[model samples]
Target chain A: MNFLSFGHYHHDMCLVLHRSLQLDNNSMLSFTLAMRDGQAFDTVLSRAKSMGLAVREGRLLASAKPVARAFSIQDPDRHWIEIILEN
Target chain B: MSNSAFIPPNVLPPLLQKFAPLLKRKWFRELVLLWPTLTRRRFSNKTEDYGVFKPSLVGHFGQLAVYVQDIARSRIWYQKVAGLTHSRTSDPEPHPSKPGWTLRACYMSAKEHDECLVLLEERDPSGKMSVPSGMSFFHFALEVEGNRKEDVFAFAAQQKRDGFHLNYGPVQHNSEPPDGDGETGGNVACYLYDPDWHNVEFCGAMDTIENYRARYGDKKGSDRN
Candidate 1:
């Protein structure tokens, strides 16, 4: 299984922090999205709740460069998504 | 000299330690001035990282990826609908979680569009395809540059005629809400489902999270400065 890959976004921009995970032995390629579209981070969380999306465990992600508040969620398709905002 | 001074320096002094490394760096500005002689001297071909933050890492919209149960079927569907051709597959990346194995990946580009879509799949020993379920990625948009959004809609309509699953319309998505006044500062978009359930979208706009949020969320305005 070699076709699983992550879609890299536009090159001219930036993400405050990022990380990835491999959930499948051969066919699955997944990433925990700690950053989002230009919307504010907390607003994303609140909107997610309003949409009835499940928010999983949350913890402070510590990095020397930037401090981030993060949480996880599972979509209808069972894909786990992590939302993060740098504080 | 005292015992401390007797320890003759092999490395630079503490104050020089940091700048010494910078002076020896390949991307260092002074090195370019020295390169005329340095290259002739054949000091070293190795290049240095100018900064830890690199725009090249995220440079360019590389690929719009989606999940597929059967790659061959997906390929045929894309070819028929969007006139996308199989550009190439890259060497499998080392599986992040699995040991002694690699992940398979390929890039397919449209003749009309500069960007490509990444198809990720896996095959068993018996040659049967295994697809992972539940992709978290909402949708990816293709920029309309020289190609007109009207042309995109026409092509999408034709795809429907050609028997592809045209899930949604060549309609203007509302910028503020799920359904609102149709003054779309957002994107003129159409949605399609591949052979698998991967939701693919074509938008007549450039790459922006504002576009993504407009389609997927309730927010009308962008918070980014």
Candidate 2:
């Protein structure tokens, strides 16, 4: 069993990765990362593209009120990562 | 599984002790059934107050644990792409449920948040166990900041350049609970899929549950009906 950890310097956050033999590609869990603003959101989108990753961008409405702009990307395990900027 | 019935004599109240022996007799049991009638009489008296208990909860989002195929690839994708920081990894140990197997896992978190994401893996030397079919939960969400609309468009444009498409949203919705007791506020959100086909959502401007009562008064959805 091998593992690695990644730390975000600007924030007191970290993610740990573990290696296992069991492979279940189906997961019911999803998580979100809030960006500071549109700029921060764009930075992540650009970073994904620079890494040759695919990204999806769209708008979101709440009760018919346009309140956010967001994008989606997939991690290596096929989990959806949604990045949102509020209007 | 057994036809015989047994009652511990000590469990009967002192007043009912005299009747305990008679209970074993089928004919006496049929004629002496008073408990059901008493129970129905008590229940029919609606004037009596019967307090129900509910749990007190803070309603804070906590940690999520997930199983992944490849820990290293998923770790780099989350750290580099998702921008999550690495926390710690646990030493390999025997699987909690699977015998003769080993288990390992790692934890990750975002800035300023104690809530974490745990990735777990399991291995067996015989390779007899099959991968899990899916997780039980429907989905979990993370909130992000959104200020300007143009940034979202820019993000979409970037994705288009990278040959990707937004799976859903850029829509507004009523931030109302399904029970219809809370005040309906507005929220904007979108969706995407992760490596394991998990549905991830990005949302902004969510409503708080506190003001729903004041705004809607005592008229709950059930009351309206």
Return the top candidate by DockQ.
Answer: 2
**Model 2, A18-84: lDDT tens per residue?**
2322333333233445566666666778888999887766521111113366666767766555565
Index of the highest-lDDT prediction: 1
B1-225 per-residue lDDT for model 1 (tens digits): 001112112212446433432432324524543765565743222111112232221113323445465566777777666667887665545433335434455557776543256676654544455554433443455544344557666767777787664555565433233322132333556666555555566656432343343444543222210
Looking at candidate 2 chain B, the ten consecutive residues that score lowest on lDDT are: B43-52
lDDT of 1 by residue, A1-87 (tens): 011112232112221111232232222243334344335556767878999987754531111113256665655545444455544
Off by over 4 Å in 1: A1-87, B1-59, B89-96, B100-102, B112-115, B123-129, B144-147, B175-185, B205-225
Candidate lDDT scores, in order, read 0.45, 0.43
- List candidate 2 stretches off by more than 4 Å: A1-87, B1-55, B124-132, B146-165, B175-185, B211-225
- State the RMSD for candidate 2: 22.5
For residues B68-141, write the lDDT of model 2, one tens digit per residue.
55556556555643357777777766653346876556667777554257665556667442243444333344
